[model samples]
Target: MNGFTGELIGTAILIVFGVGCGANSNLKGAYGKGSSWLYLCLCWGFAVAFGVYAAGQFGADGHLNPAITLGFAAFGFFPWSKVGAYLLGQFIGAFIGALIVIIQYWPHFQIAKGKDDGNVINIFATAPAIRNPLFNFLGELIATFTFTFVLLNLGDFTQGLKPLVVGFLITVVGQGLGGTTGFALNPARDLSPRLAYALLPIPNKTSADWAYAWVPIFGPIVGGILAGGLQYLLH
Candidate 1:
């Protein structure tokens, strides 16, 4: 019911259901290789929508992503004191949800393609399948930028369309730009899961791919901040 509790619960559910479905499907090769993208985006977006629908009316602010909260804070939509709390809650939720993914999929870790230690962390976080950090970073930046831009355009919470716009923006970006690096648009979405993968017991793991970790964290946050700045200037 409180802000922190609402954010934590919402984010945990989002990561668990959204990332879980897609990542799990990827490991299984169920919808064909990487077929989980669309469903993943939809799940995340719909999750956001539902979370807001339930939590927003209660003055929850419902930022499932730290970047989202930070973006609004930069735009002055969120207060300074509360932004940190929201971020803390988001990460906590992400960490918890990531643990669930690791525990649930421990069995498939050994059998999943690219599951070796070489890309172990990649499962929890993200990486460029093609090894080109330039394009990978660019893809993530653009997607987050697009999401932020739309958020700004939606304006104040006069109608509740803001949340829907945010969801739609993410869904579109995932469709258009997700191919390169799976679009790690939210920091918690990647880092939390990556941490779980690094800690979870798995056989024949390669390296956890820690080298490519920061991109997801910094890229989306920067994108959100820049979008907030740009929106401020335009107004």
Candidate 2:
């Protein structure tokens, strides 16, 4: 009910949807991916919208992503002193979500993946559609900008239509840009699940791809700030 609680609970649900899709895809005899691209995208959008609806009044950043928080903080919407708390809360929530997901999909991990292939196991974390950092960064920047811009405009109390726009915008990003970077538009989306990947007892798991971790964390931060700055300049 408090700020941290809202963030923690909301983040867990958000990861559940995202990670649940990944686990469902690999279930034995599950056929080709149980969910489609569009389904997942809009699912993500509503996930945040609903999460915020519940937690927004509770004082949670409803941030789901560090970049948005940091972006707003850079513009003075969030407090510098509290960013750490928000990040910590988000990370903890992500860990719990990923753990729940892994438990929920234990059977599939044993069956479809045969407990091999770190790549298969990592859908719970995230992987890039393309390994190139340049394109990956570009995708994140563009996606974050689109999402953040929508948020800024819809933020005013006088305009009650922002939530729909943000939700729709999230769907758009997932449909268009999610194929790259698995669309880690949210830092919590990446880092929290990642910590789970590191600790979960899956048969085979990779290094969490630390070599490229910076891309998601910084890319969204950059994109969010750029979006906020542009909005500030324009209005």
Instruction: Give the number of the best model, judged by lDDT.
Output: 2
Q: Residue 104 lDDT in model 1?
A: 69
Per-residue lDDT tens digits of candidate 2, residues 1-235?
3667777777787788777766666455444355677766776777666656554556675776778877878877667887777777777887888899888766655655443422363466556777898888888888888778777776641125544565677778888877887677888888778767777786544466677777887788899999888887887
Model 1: colliding residue pairs: 117-205, 117-206, 117-207, 118-206, 118-207, 124-193, 124-194
lDDT for each residue of candidate 1 in 1-235, tens digit (9 for 90 to 100) = 3777767877777677665665555564333335456776686677666655544654567667777788878888678888776787778888887777666666666566465323245456677767787777777788888887776676553246766766666677778887688788889878887776677665445566778888788888888888888888888
lDDT on C-alpha atoms for all candidate structures: 0.70, 0.71
Give per-model TM-scores.
0.83, 0.86
Model 2 root-mean-square deviation: 2.9
The candidate 1 region of ten consecutive residues with least summed lDDT is 113-122
What TM-score does candidate 2 get on C-alpha atoms? 0.86
